[model samples]
Target: MQFRYLGRSGLKISEITYGNWLTHGSQVENDIATQCVRAALDAGITTFDTADAYANTKAETVLGDALAGERRESLEIFTKVYFPTGPAGPNDSGLSRKHILESINGSLTRLKTDYVDLYQAHRYDFETPLEETMQAFADVVRQGKALYIGVSEWTAEQLREAHALAVDLGVQLISNQPQYSMLWRVIEPEVVPTSKELGIGQIVWSPIAQGVLTGKYAPGQPLPEGSRATDEKGGADMISRFMNDRVLTAVQELKPVASDLGLSMAQLAVAWVLQNDNVSAAIIGASKPEQVHDNAGASGVKLDADVLKRIDEALGDLPESDASQTRSPQGRPS
Candidate 1:
């Protein structure tokens, strides 16, 4: 596996991180989730990303069980806050001091670890003061609960403000986790530049656009059985944005590009995100062990200028690059 430094932090993470988001506790059975985690480890992946909000905190437990016997020092485990996980109480969510402190303790216990390599704000809390949030994160770092701090789906301005506060509080805001893929370019224009200037790396999610880039969904054909588009728990809604015929047709055009590179559609999609120098890793979720092995192959793959141009051409105007598209909840969750 290829590893990269997260942002400017000394910590190196596998470029292809195994993430349990829609799967693990929700879509896949516990046994299958454990098998997938083992498959990732076997494929040389040492980075694992999860969140307390996933499956109402069940994802963290499953991941903890899966990594129980692994050498703790060799793995970089990450989790997040800012979403209602427990009882969805007012104090159960957001980045308030109370929530951050309580959430970290709960997360550490659920992950079966003393400290997470990185702890991210799952989303920006408009209701909370940014200072309170950063201060709490600093405390988490100083207390040895999380080594570094990060935020997900935060805007460029939000990142700028948070990074400044993080610096003042003496915490390392090392990474930003966002949805970035061939079909989703929202981070390219604003977030990437701001993060680069702030010395933050991107841990991008949905590099395959929720499996749309896998070419499994045909332009005018029926939805693939058991595909993400058909997952009702949450996947179907997340992938719904790309389910239209125009997007599907554009996605299908990349099949030949993958063939030319001798890569499966999924591998191409994963590698495409890694092409960005600022992207330290691409988060890949899996329901099966083979899927982990397949996506892991994208670790060190390089896509040249020609291939990149072909990708853009195939995708056409289907990609979303507006800076406004990168946003968090306008109001507090729950």
Candidate 2:
């Protein structure tokens, strides 16, 4: 597996990071999730990403169990805060000092690790003072619960503000996790430039547009049984925006390009995201072990100028690049 330094930080992470977002403790059986993690390790992936909010905190436990015997020093495990977890109390979410502090402890306990390689704010907390959140993150670093700080789906301005605060607080803000793919180019216009200026790399999720770019959901066809589009366990909601015929029809155009490159549609999609220089890693999740092995092949695959242009032509204005789409919750979760 190819590894890249996250932003300007000294740490290097596998270009393909195994993430358990919708699968681990919710969609897939525990044994399958463990096998997927095992597959990732067998494919030379050393980075694993999860969140405390995933499956109401069960995802971390499953990942921890999956990674139980591995040498800790050889893996980069990351998790996040900023979503309503536990009982969904008044203070159960957001980046408030209490939540960030308590969440880290809970996350550490669930992950079966003393410290995460990087701890992230899952989303920007509009209700909490940025100072309070960054200060709490700095404290997380000082306490050695997390080695570095990061954020997810934060706007460029938010990143700028947080990076400044992180510097003032004497902590490193190294990465931003966002949904970035061939079909979801929302981060390219603004977030990428700002993160580059602030010395932050992107750990992009949904590099396949939640499987849309895999050419599986064809236009004029019924939604595949058990596919993410048919999943009611939050996956359907996340992948719904890209389910229209216009998008699906356009996605099918990339099949030949994948064939020409001797790549599968999924590999083409993942490689397309990694072509962006500022992207440190692309997070891939799986329901089965074979899926992990297939997607992992995208690592270290290079797409040249002509192939990139052909991809853009095939996608043709179907990609979403609006900077305004890079958003956080309007209010604190309750």
Candidate 3:
């Protein structure tokens, strides 16, 4: 697998990062999750991403257990903080000093690792002072609990503020984990440029548009049985937006383009995201082993201009590229 440096940082991560968001310890059994992680490793993936909030923190444990025997230095394991984990106390969430400090130890304890390669704020915490959040991250790095810092889904303005604080605090805020995909181009207009200038690369999630770009959810057809949309433990709500006929039909049109390029729809979707130089890695969550194998093929594939044009024409008006539409999460981390 191809690897890229996270922004200007010295850390190198696999271009395709294996993530377990909703699948591990919730939708999929621990054994199934272990099989998926093994599949990722077999495919040459060395980066794994998870979060403290995923499946109420069980995801980290499953990932840690799955990765037990691997050489720690050879893998880049990333996890995020934010949202509520454990009991729903007022201080149980956000980027507050207490949460950030307490969360790291809890995360390390559960993951059975002394330090994560990168620690990210899962969402922009507008409620906390930016100084407090950035300083806390700096402290984490200083204490060797985390090697680097990042933020997810932060607006350009929020990123700029955090970037400045990180610089002042002498911490390297290396990446932003945002919801970016073939359909969700929300970060392209502003976040990408701002991050590029700030020496931060984007590690994008949902490159498949929550599985919409795979062309499996056919127009006028019922939700695929046993799919994430039909599974309550999976990300049903996130995938629901692309369930409409308009989006499904447009996604289906890209199948021929994929065929012409000797690619599957999922590979096409992943390659489309990697085409953006600002993106360092694309995070893919898998329930089954084969799904990880399929996505790993997109790591080094290149798409030509004709194929990209065909994709644009097929997608038409469904792309969300407007910078103005990017907003801070409404007091909830998704």
Candidate 4:
């Protein structure tokens, strides 16, 4: 796998990061999760991303256990806060000082590590004071609990404010993790440019548009059995927006593009996002080991200009690039 620096930091991470969001501890059993992790390691993926709120905080424990025997220095581990992870309490959520501090401790314990390579705010906490959140993140770095800081799905305005506060606090806000894909381009217009100017890199998730770009969900076919669409645990609903005929058909149009490039639909989708210089890595979630190996094929693949234009044409207007649609502060769990 190809490696790239995380933002302007000296640290480097695999271009394809193995992420366990809906799969680890929830969609897949722990033993299968271990196999997937091993597959990622075998494919030369050194970066792993998880969140404290994923699977009600069980994802961190499972990922920690899976990586327990690996050399700590050989991996880049990332996790996030800002979503409720435990029993519903007022302070059990958001970027409040109480939540950020306590959440880090909880995450470290569950991860079985003293520090994470990067700590991110899972969402923009509209409820908290920006200064309080920034200061708390600075304190995390000062305490060596996290080597660097990042934010997920923060709008350009929110990121600007937080970045200024981070600079004032003498801390490096190194990265931003957002939902980016062939179908979701919300970060392109504003977030990507702003992050590039501010020395922050974009570590994008859902490059496959929740499996829509994989070309597995055909226009008129039934939902793939045992796929995320048929997953009874809510993965189906998460991908419902792209289940329509128009989206599925548009995705089907890209099959030839993949064929011309000698890439699987998933590889083309992942590589499409990496074409942007600001994107440091694309996080891929998998249920099977083969998925990990298949996505790794996109690691160093380069898409020429004509292929990119064809992708845009094939996708038509189905992509969402509006900055407004982002930072919605919705009910998404990581």
Candidate 4 backbone collisions, by pair: none
Against the reference, the lDDT scores of all candidates come to 0.95, 0.95, 0.91, 0.92
What's the C-alpha lDDT at position 151 in model 3?
Answer: 88
The backbone clash count of each candidate, in order, is 1, 0, 0, 0
Arrange candidates by lDDT, descending. 2, 1, 4, 3
Off by over 4 Å in 4: 330-334
- Across 1-334, the per-residue lDDT of candidate 1 in tens digits comes to 9999999999999999999999989999999999999999999999999999999999999999999988999999999998897789879999999999999999999999999999999999999999999999999999999999999999999999999999888889999999999989999999999999999999999999999999999987988888899998999999999999999888888989999999999999999999999999999999899999999999899999999999999988889999899888888878
- Residue 34 C-alpha lDDT in model 1: 98
Model 2, 1-334: lDDT tens digits are 9999999999999999999999999999999999999999999999999999999999999999999999999999999998889899999999999999999999999899999999999999989999999999999999999999999999999999999999999999999999999888999989999998999999999999898989999999999888999899899999999999999998889999999999999999999999999999999999999999999999999999999999999889989899999999899876
Error of 3 at 323 (Å): 1.9
TM-score of each: 0.99, 0.99, 0.98, 0.97
Q: How many backbone clashes does candidate 4 have?
A: 0
Worst 10 residues of 1 by lDDT: 325-334
Question: What is the alpha-carbon lDDT of model 2 when measured against the actual structure?
Answer: 0.95
Question: Candidate 1 — which residues are off by over 4 angstroms?
Answer: none
